[model samples]
Target: MIDILLVPIVLVIILVMLHSYFGMEILKRGIIFTDLAIAQFAALGSSISLGYFHEEHFYLLTLSFALFSAFLIAFASTRKLHLEAFIGILYVLGASGIMMVLSHSAEGMEHFKSLLASDILFTPPMEVAKSAVIYAFIAIALYFIYPKLSGFLKELLFFSLLAITVTSSVSLAGVFVVFVLLIAPPFVALSLNFKKPLLGSFIFGWFFSISAITISYFYDLPTGYSVVFLGAFLTALVVLAASKKALEN
Candidate 1:
């Protein structure tokens, strides 16, 4: 049981590292909603799959759906018209669809509930392994492509990474807190501008992760919500301090 809990927490650390890295890039590009939208879409897709498939195949379905959604969103962003409105519409429709799917099936409701609020404490070792592998692939892809990622392509890759991170984290931490994993570290890195953005992001992510997990362990708070609140508070402090420093300068 201790092992099971540790696995997911470790995976969450890795996920947050990757999220912070790409999240900083996304923040630089001004397309934060892309993460939230893709996550919702992946949830919607997974719910639909659960209605038809059994538990064993659900992970594959989730990965496939998330990747597909990322591709679609990336493609849409390249168009002349602003894609924010379209992505917003998709988020609403996807969330609605998830609720509808949950309402219709009995067993599906249990799965949906789990999906809506992840049991990170009881997350399977297999799931953690899978997440680790996925995160590695994303990290490698980002490293190689990063030099070439400029202009629209850069924006697209950042959005794609955000989508992947949010969808995966939402599955573990719930969608509500995925926002924290997406936004907070970047804000911390931005405020500090500590010479190396990636290093700053990793430090901030570790700080937020450790603080949240400790609070959850001692206070019996919801881990996800605790992380989000702590991250938000820290981010707000950083922003305010940076603003004051800027004013003085």
Candidate 2:
């Protein structure tokens, strides 16, 4: 059990640390669904690669589509339009596009389910290491380059980095897993007004993710969806309870 879970535990910890930062920033911008839209687009690219090309060019296509979505969202951010609504529309379009692409594939439904959430318990060690390297580079950029940018350039860089992150994460953990990791723990930390919200997010994310992994291992449940379910369910309960208390007080 220890050997089996060690890689996954490390992967989840890395995911939570990186995603919590973006999740906090996304919440601050009040564009909650931007990550979802970008993730959907990335999934669309993967679907295209699977359906038409037999999974060749998967990374290239996924990164390309994710970057495309990021560019559109960044542009919309500078416009006078309803940004959230626009992002919602982009999400739907990517979703519908994915369905259309995969409609003819024999493994269409299975592929779709995997896109939504994969069995991260069986994730490859090499893949985890690769993603970690990519994330490290992204973190360096965010620390140095991101702080110096302003205006539309800043928005583009931010979303582009997010797209890159989602592209890798979507392939590894699936879309809903990425979304939850990007939102849930951060949402809880922000709602509770934690001083070091990122640290709080890491704690919450690690708690739910590790707990879910343990439960899934013992119960023979799907690991990715287990994480998604526990993260979402627990975060929603916490936020709702907090909101109710705030309203009362």
Candidate 3:
């Protein structure tokens, strides 16, 4: 059981670091909603594909759908209308379509529940391996592209990373905890005035994630919710301390 949990926890930490980096980039660029929107779109696409595809094909279907969602968002960002508004509309439409598709299928509720909240504890070993491979691809892609990604390309990369991170995280931590992973570490790092922001964010993410998992293991609390609460609490304490230090200075 410890070994099983350890692998997923390590994967979650790597994902959290990638998520924090791109999330901060998105926040800086004022495209926060882009992540949520693309994630919903990917979820809808994956949920729909599951109706016709086997479990083995699920990751491929999800990756295709996620990439398509990224393309659509990137295209829309270049148009005259507000990207945020467009993303909102796309989210609603995609989400509604997914619900409609699921309504006609026998496994609808099961798939929907998985898409909505995820069940990391029940994740199969094969699926864990698959997720790790996907994370590897994402990490490598980001590493190579980081140098060339600038201007609109940087934003595009942000959208892509957000989509991948959100989808992967939603499969484990759910959307709420995904949001926590995206936001909390940066908050902690910023409040602490860390010199190396990326390193600081990564440290905070790992600390909060491990703490949350420990709390969930010892107590009966939901892992995802525990993570969010612990992250928020830590961020608040860091900010408060920072504020006090500033006042003293």
Q: Rate the local accuracy (lDDT) of all candidates.
A: 0.72, 0.96, 0.72
In model 3, which range of ten residues has the least summed lDDT? Answer: 114-123
Residue-pair clashes per candidate, as listed? 0, 0, 0
Which candidate tops lDDT? 2
Between the candidate structures 2 and 3, which one is better when assessed by TM-score?
Answer: 2
Worst 10 residues of 1 by lDDT: 113-122
Candidate 2 clashing pairs, residues 3+ apart or interchain: none
Report the alpha-carbon TM-score of model 3 versus the true structure: 0.79
Tell me how many residue pairs clash in candidate 3.
0
- Would you list the clashing residue pairs of candidate 3? none
State which candidate, 2 or 3, has the greater lDDT: 2
Cα lDDT, model 1, residue 114: 59
TM-score of each: 0.82, 0.98, 0.79
Model 3 spans with C-alpha error above 4 angstroms = 52-56, 104-107, 149-154, 232-249
lDDT tens per residue, model 2, 1-77: 99889888999999999999999999999999999999999999999999999999999999999999999999999
Worst 10 residues of 2 by lDDT: 240-249
